[model samples]
Target: AAALEAYDGHERVWCGRDEERGLVALVGIHNTALGPALGGTRVWPHESFEAGMTDVLRLSRGMTYKAAVAGLPFGGGKAVIIADPKKDKTEALLEAYAEMLVALDGQYYTGEDVGLTLADADFIRERAPNISGTSKGGSGNPSPVTAEGVFLGLKAALAHKSGSDRLAGVLVAVQGLGSVGWSLCEKLHAEGAELVVADIDTDAVDRAANTFGARMADAGDILFVEADILAPCALGGLFSSDTIPQLKAGIIAGAANNQLARHEDARLLMERGILYAPDYVINAGGLMNVAAELAPGGYNREATMRKVTEIPRTLTAIFQKADAEKRPTNEVASDIAMARIADKRS
Candidate 1:
């Protein structure tokens, strides 16, 4: 009932329990006016059932806007299995989760997200056919595409701030060495950007340093580091009342979803002269990649990349509108996404 109160016009929400496998899952279909609702499956250890539901609700809504702004013929939906991936993930649990998705029919489709991977997607596909980002489907991993979009979005933010989009010689503080972060670091390094990388995972951090020559920073200090851009490629809510005042970076952009702890943080960053690339808009590359598989003539890598290339243009448009209206970029982005959803409803 509390979850329903927080629905935000969600089309449907389902909660399932698999006692046999000790699995609990929630699926939220935020919208489907454009087409079927599509998002990713996230498996994580949630403190409570409500927390897991909230995650699905929030992420599913983000997917709606992400698909709308990215011009995909899909709505937004998300699934979450409440368990620690390291210790709780078993083949039986994954298969049970897949069965839950199947029960929903074709209304929702899923791919990979945090705590889930392509291999997991493959496992889910055995029980559910409406899955994307499978190795068999030729989509491969979505991280590289996601990172590519973030790289371009960051460039657009840089152009908005300094009148030059060149990344060479620019200092970047990347606060996550995950797949997306690592790929983003590679792109930044290729463009000669000075990198300071950090992650809770020591191996990931070490790999970034060894592979890309990124200087290592402790996770606690990465947010406050004095750099031209702060790339949050990890968890959300890094920008808050306490951290906003401490941010020394001129621009905030990365692959992480929900970077702001609260909506008002957008205004705080704007007042501080920090340009932010709205998370969903900048991180739509994976969606773009998978949406290609649904293309009428089948997936084409070149065509899919062409769509991914439009991300910078989208960010530039948001920045332009924000400037014209004297509003935070986040607000502008929300307006754009909401307007599209409204249009479809109308």
Candidate 2:
């Protein structure tokens, strides 16, 4: 505890919990350079306490740098709740977690991520004033914005990695069909890209396969599907050495954050001749647009388009730097984001 000071440095950090309602929350605060920490709350059925801790801490830190790199006014922070979305969501549980968050004052602000919804967030906000990403009478769902960013990044990856700016016949294997994945698939399908989709939710899998004539795979088989691109719209760290050995894809670009099993895996992907689009970099588009909505007159669609499309440019630059210096792309990108974060000493 004495040694863990920086948010990114702590692999296991404590995020207060609500025992009465059996809700476990892990909050990761990456930086406060711009202002108070801002992040989203992701609820999932986690297997262990350690997994929850590792995810929250890493994601929170990623948010910090993501915001910094995107030039947003918010700091990085993330919250994770341990529970199966299908089995364990209760109003009492959410309110209890909200109470825990309210106790933090304004040091951390939460929006919605992954398993949590805007409505769920609003339920939490009933008790905790710190949550963001609600309907608020007009914001609509965040999935479209997030998917838009991912689409732009995918275009970038295809151009940078596949040596073709067109995805007309590219084989793209998508691992999830949630709001983000579904919209992303739509964009890819409309672009004439062939798609193979998978998801734990049978309804979602069936919808995508039926609507778009996509080939479907078993949930676990999503990883090994032979394709040109693997889009992980589901979760993080699916790119472990074990899984890496199974993939025959040329590139990986998705909306999920923190996709590496470990940070070093970024280089491992490179070593295997797979061009990796840094998850945080590509996924920053939605958050950037969200932050814009908080500004005066909301967001400017044209301006946001120009800014969001820059994700690939940034990734391309990082790839070039890594190639020139013969270093890992992750290291160069981290250094860039870290330099902008506030330096703190304990």
Candidate 3:
């Protein structure tokens, strides 16, 4: 019931199922004040429809704030399919999900997310004609760009906390060695940051150790490792009351969406003197990159990156405001986004 009650004034919500094809998904459009909904589709093995519903609602809302904060001319939306991506994903199932997108009549555009890939985007685009992030005519992959944004945001966080954005000698504990996380580690390593990395995939961790000369931490211990920064490139909801007390890192910056388990966790982190870069704000480079496909002329990497570079400026402003008001960075960032959306609506 609490999951069903997790509504946050979403503009539209749709749940579709094709039992024969083993497809079950939920799409939540949180706002369209600026433009049509643009977000990626996540294929996760949620325990139930309610869990998927909760994830979709929260993720879609975060997308809205992400786009608004990034000054994108698109609204926020998200989709989640209730199945293990590795085991349950199929062309037929993706086609069925695309049909659901077609039914929405272009109000929502889908791309790639947690469990999906560029190939999956291409398949969905062929059937739905409203998808981005495909390898052919859209942004090929957004992970690298997203990592760049986080890299810049982390530098900004460093500057805000220590007065210099230099990464040399800084110890960053990166959790998750996925595409985005791996790319981020590369950037940080190039900047001379010492890395302590972890991932459930031992292979990834071992690779990082070899390539970046990173120290390896067990997946569960990475969060509490004594490092200058903790980058949670894995799943969301990692910063909660239970875990905040154990965080040894002074700064939290990462590409994961919904990092805070609850709104109050921001304050908890603040209380512990952890400077948190809002998850959506820092992870928006992928959305910005993919949404460029909808631009008048088409996707332009130069223009997209030009915009992505502004992520740090935005974070700096939010950090200054948070410091002035003694408020959580997430709260301040959300207010700024909400204000932008309200102004657009009016």
Candidate 4:
């Protein structure tokens, strides 16, 4: 009940524990008005159960808005496994988590998120059928598709901020070099953008520097780098009152979820003249790809790509609406998403 207090308007939240197998997980189903909840399973080394709960709640709610805004026939849901994927992930642990998905009985369909790979999705698929992003029959790794969406959305932000959207000579500071971030860098580099990158993985950062001629910055300093754009492809809650005042980028657009620590952070960005592409609106490509697997005719890469291409259009509309209303982009995007969800419910 105490945990429920934190969930507020969520539809359902499942907590699973298996001490013998060293399994602890939380799955939050935020809404299902559009369809069954479809989101990814994120495995992270959370500090405590309460921390994991907070993450799951916020991520699940974001998933709901993501689906609604992306115009996908799905609702929002997310799962979090409380452990380090490197040291604690095991076959037994995955098997126990699979059982929890089984118990969900189709209310939620999950794929891979941070700290998870396509191989991990395959392992989970062996025990549970309610999973996407599997190598065999699912959409495979969604990083590239996700990167494509972010790239397109970033262009929209650039076009809205300035009259031109060309990436040539634009300096972009990317804050992470994971699969999606690396893929995004490839796209940005191909478009002639100058890259300033940072990552905890030295090898990944080195590769970016060598391949894209990127200048490497410390992970902590990447956020404050004096660049035209800041792409935060890492974790969430990076933008708050304190950090917003220090931002040097004119635009903030990335694949990270929940970039703002609070709702008011959007207003802060607005006041500071930073154009923010709402994380969920810009990062729905992965969800769209995985949702393709659930289509009656099965996954179609071409069709999915067509849908992903519309991300820029969606962002452009949001930008225009925000400008006309003199409101923050995040708030405008959220209102549009909620209106869509409400229309469906009505």
Task: Please give the CA lDDT of all the candidate structures.
Answer: 0.89, 0.79, 0.93, 0.93
Model 4 misplacement above 4 A: 1-6
| TM-score, per-candidate, Cα-based | 0.96, 0.90, 0.98, 0.98
Question: What clash count does candidate 4 reach?
Answer: 0
Looking at model 2, which ten-residue stretch has the lowest summed lDDT?
1-10
Q: For each predicted model, how many residue pairs clash, with residues at least 3 apart or on different chains?
A: 0, 1, 0, 0
Number of clashes found in candidate 3: 0
TM-score of 2: 0.90
**TM-score head-to-head 2 vs 4, winner:** 4
Q: Model 4: which ten-residue window has the lowest total lDDT?
A: 1-10
Global lDDT for candidate 3? 0.93
TM-score of 4: 0.98
Model 3 vs. true fold: TM: 0.98
lDDT of 2 by residue, 149-264 (tens): 88877887788765776988889999889878999999999989999999988999889988888999888998788999999999887988788878888888898887887788
Residue 7 lDDT in candidate 2:
36
Error of 4 at 244 (Å): 0.2
Q: Per-residue lDDT tens digits of candidate 4, residues 1-346?
A: 4345447599988999999999999999999998899999999999989889989998999999999999889999999999999999999999999999998889899998998789999999999999998899788999899999999999999999998999999999999999889999999999999999999888999999999999999998999999999999989989999899999999999999989988678999999989999999999999999999998899999999999999999999999999899999999999988999999989
TM-score of 1: 0.96
Model 1 lDDT per residue over 230-288, tens place: 99998776799998999999999999876887767899999998999999999999999
Q: Which ranges in model 3 have alpha carbons more than 4 Å from their true place? A: none
